[model samples]
Target: MSTETVIPKVEKKHLENPTGGSKMEKVPGKPFMEIHDEINDEGQGNFPLILDDSVETQTQEDVKPKRMRKLTSGGQEMYEKEVEKYTAELIHYRKNLYILINSYYSGELETLEVRLMPDRINKELSKYQQISEKFIGFLKRYRTAESAREEATQKIIFKSIVSKAKTILNEIEIKLKQAQLAKSFATGRKFKPPSASSMLIKQRAKMDAAKTNLRFASKEAEPERLQFKLEEEELKTKAELLKKKVEAKLQMELLKSEKEVAIAETEFNAVREELEMEGSRSSGKSMASVVDPRQHIERYLQKQQEIMKSVYINPQQMQPPELNVHAAPFEPKSEDIRQTNYEINNVSVANELSKFLLKKESIDVSFYEI
Candidate 1:
C-alpha cells in the first residue's frame, strides 16, 4: 500500500436557487360577485340581485319545484275514488233492501223473514251512515284544497249524499212500520211449548188446572189423572231424545279431536324424516334469530318435536290456548214476536199496509148442542 492513501476530496459548490414554484400559482381565481348598496336612491323599491346570464340559466336548469302552501293538486283523484266506493256500497245496500221490501209487499216473503227485514235495513243504513260520516270528515279536512274543480265536485257530491240519506231514512221508516204492524198481529200466534216445571212452576200448575177443566168439559174418554200420566210419559221420551242428542254431540267432538291428533302426528313425522334426509339439524343458530322471531319459534317447536320423537315424553307441560266459542242455539221462527231494542211508536205505515189484521178463524159446530 502507498504511504499517501488516495483519499477522495468532497467538492463544495455554493448554489443559489429560487423557491420552487407553487402548484396553485397557475390556477385561475373565482369571479367576484359585486353587490351594490347605494343609500341615496330610497324612493324606488329594492332592486333584485342581477346575476350573470349564464349563471342564472344554469341555476334555473338545476332548480326543483317548491312545495305548495296548500293542497293545490293530487288529492282530487283520491277523493273521487273514495266517492265512487261510497256510492257503490250504498247502491248495494239499497238494492238489497229494495228487493226485501218489495218481496214482502208482493206477499212472496214469510212473516218472520219480513220482521227481520227492518233490522237488516237498519243495520245496512247504519253501516252506510258510518261510511258517509267518514267521507264527510275527510271532505271537511280537505275543504281547503285550492283546486277549483275539486271544490265544485265536492259540493255536488255532498248534495247527492244528503238527498240519498234522506230518501233512505224515509224508506227505512216506512219498512220499519210495516214490520211493526206485521209483528203486532203475530203476537200470541206461535206454538207455545209446554213449560218445564223448574222454569215456571206456578204458571205450569195454572195451565194444568185449565187443561184439566178443558179435558173434563170436552168429550175425552180418559179421566184427568190418566191424561196427566200420559203427558209424564211423553216428557220422559223427550228427555231421552235430549240425552241422545248430547251424547251424539260429545261423540262428534271426540272424533274431531282424535282426527286433529292424528293429523298433527303425521305432519310431525313427515317433517322429522325430511329434516333427517337433509342432514339439517336444528342448530343453536336456528333456535334463536333476531331477524325473524316467528321462524325461530317454529324452529324451536320443530326441535321440541324432534326431541319428543327421540326421547319419551310423559306429557307436554303447556297446551295451546283454548278459545271458548259459544254457539247460539237456533230458535224456531216463532210468530210470538218479542219487543225490539229500538222504539217504534213514532214509526207509521201506509194506510193500506197498516190494516194487517189477524185472520178470522171459523169453527162451525158439527153436532147440535141442544
Candidate 2:
C-alpha cells in the first residue's frame, strides 16, 4: 500500500456494474488507427484518414430553388372571377364604342358626337387592351410553374385574344375604306343641276330676235323682265329636284355601309365571346384549341339569319333604296341628313379631311403593333 501506484492503459466510459458501483469500459465502435515508423529502414510511410460519418454530400435536387406550383382551387376560382369580370365589362364597353363609331360612319351623330367618337373609341380599345394584358399577366403569375398542357392552353387563349383585338381594328379600317369608296362612287354619279342663266340662254336669244315683234301684235309679247322671272322659277324647281335626288342617293349609300358595319360588329363580338368561353373551360380535361374565328362568326351569323329571317336584312339581297335606313337607330334619317349638312357647312371640308387622315394614320400604326 505504501509504494504501489498502477497506471491506466486506456481512457474509458462509465457503465453500471453489478454491485451498484461504477466500472470502466472501453468506448464501443471506435475506429482503429495504425501507424508504422521504420525511419532507419523504410523509404516512405502512408496513412489513410477519413472524416466523421455525420458529414453528407447533397444531391442536385436539393441544391436548387423550386419552381412555383399550379394554383390551388380557391386561387383558381378567384382567377376565374376576376377574368370574367374584366371580359364582361370589356365587351360592354366595346359594344358601346362600336355603336358610337357606327353612328359617326353613318352620319347620324351630332357634330359634337362625331368629334368625340374617335376619342371614345380609342378609350374603349385602350381599356380592352389593358384588360387583356392584365389577364395575361395574372395568368402567368399563377401558372408560371404549370405543366406543359396548362401552359399550352394559356398560350392559345392569349393568342386568340390578341388576334381578335387586332382583327377588330382591321374590321374598322375595312369599314372606313368601304364607306369612302361608296361615297366616291355616289359623288361621281350624282347629277349636276343647270344654273338659271344657262337654263335661259335660248329664251334670252329668242327675246333679242323678237324685238321687231314687240311693236307688232304677237304671242311673244311677254316682257323681258317677266321672261327672266319665269326662267328663274323654272331653274329653281329643277335644282330642288336634283338636290333631293342627290340627298337620297347619299342616304342610300350611308345605309348600305352601316349594314355591312353592323354585320362586321356582330362577327367581332362572336369571335370574342367564343374565345372567352374557351378560356373558361374546366381544367380536368384538356382545353380545346382556338377554332378559326371566322368560321365561328360565320356559323353564328348564319344560324341567326336562319332562325330570324323575318327581321334579318340581307345586305347582299336588298338594294340600298330598299334598305329601310330609318329603321336602324344608327342610320341617318332626314333630320340626321339636315344635321350633317349643317355640320359640314359649318365645319370646313379641309378640317374634316385632316381629322380623317389623322385617324387613318393611327389605324395604320395599330396594324403594325402586336
Candidate 3:
C-alpha cells in the first residue's frame, strides 16, 4: 500500500432541500433580516404578503382628494331654498314633537306610536338644533366679516350646515319609514278585505241557513195558521176547563138539592107523624065532644035569650020558656058522658048555664022589648 495523500472532493449544490439549506437561502432574493425589517415596518409579522398591493392601493386612494360637486348660483339658490324648506320642515316637526311630548307628559296622547315618537323626535330635533346653531354662527360670521375669503369660508360653513341638516332629515325620514312599516304591520290587516274563499264560504253558509229557515217556515205553514192553531188549542183547553167547572157546579147543585129534598122529606115525615098522632087521639072522641067549650057557652046564652023573649012576649003567662039543654039527639055513650063530665068539671059549663038561666029569670020583663 503506498501512503499517498487522499483529498475528498465536495461538490457544492444549490439549496433544494429546506432542512439542509441555511434559513437565509430559503428566500429567493431578499435576506431574512430585510424580510424581518419589512414585517416589523408593516407592524404585523403574520400579515400575508399578498395583501401588500391592496394596502398600497388603499393608501393611494386615501391620499387622493375626494371629488365634490361645485354648486352654481342656481344650484346654490336651490340648495338654499331646500335648506330653508328643510329648516321650516324641521321647525314644524320640532313643534309637533314638543306638543306631543307635552301631551304625553300631561297624560294625553297615549298610544304606542305617540309613546315611541318622542325619542325619535328628540334625536332629530337635537341634530337639527346643532345644525341651526352652526348656521346661526355662520350667518353671524358672514354678517360681521366683509372679506371675500371670509365670505367664501362662511358660504362653505353654511353649505356644511345645510348638508348636516339634510343628513339629519334623512335620518328622520328613515325613522319615519320604520314607524310606517311598524304601523303597516300593526294596522294593515284591518284594512285588508276578506279573502274571496272566506267570503264565499260565509255566503254559502248564510244561504244554507236561509234555506234551512225557509224549509222550517214552509214546514210550519203561515204564521197566521200557527197562531190560529195555538189559539184553537188554548180555546179548547179553556172550554174543557169551563165544561169541567160547569159539571162540577151542576153536580154540587144536584148534591145540594138532594140534601134539601132529604131534609124536606125528614121534616114532612116528622109533621105527618105529629099530625097522625093528633088524628089518632082525636079519632077516639065524638065530633060534639070535640067541639069547642065556647060553642057550648054560646048555645046556653041563646037559650036564655029565647026564654027572656018568650017571657017578654007573654007577660000574662009568667012561666019562662023551657031550655032545650039536650039538643044533641045522639045518645051519649059512657066515654062521651065521661068526656063531657070532664069538660064540665074543667070549664064549669053546667054552672055557667045555670047562672045564665037564673039571670034571665031575674030580669024584669016590663023593661025588655021582644
Which model scores highest in lDDT?
2
Candidate 3 per-residue lDDT, tens place, 318-350, comes to 687797997877676887876555544433434
Residues 205-261 of candidate 2 have per-residue lDDT tens digits of: 889778866766354555766899999999999999999999998777667666655
TM-score of each: 0.24, 0.24, 0.24
User: Which pairs clash in the backbone of model 1?
Assistant: none
Clashing pairs in 2: none
Structural RMSD, model 1: 57.3
Name the candidate, 1 or 3, with the larger lDDT value.
Answer: 3
Candidate 3: 10-residue stretch with minimal lDDT: 48-57
TM-score of predicted structure 3: 0.24
Ten contiguous residues with the weakest lDDT in model 2: 42-51
Q: In terms of TM-score, which candidate is stronger, 1 or 2? A: 2
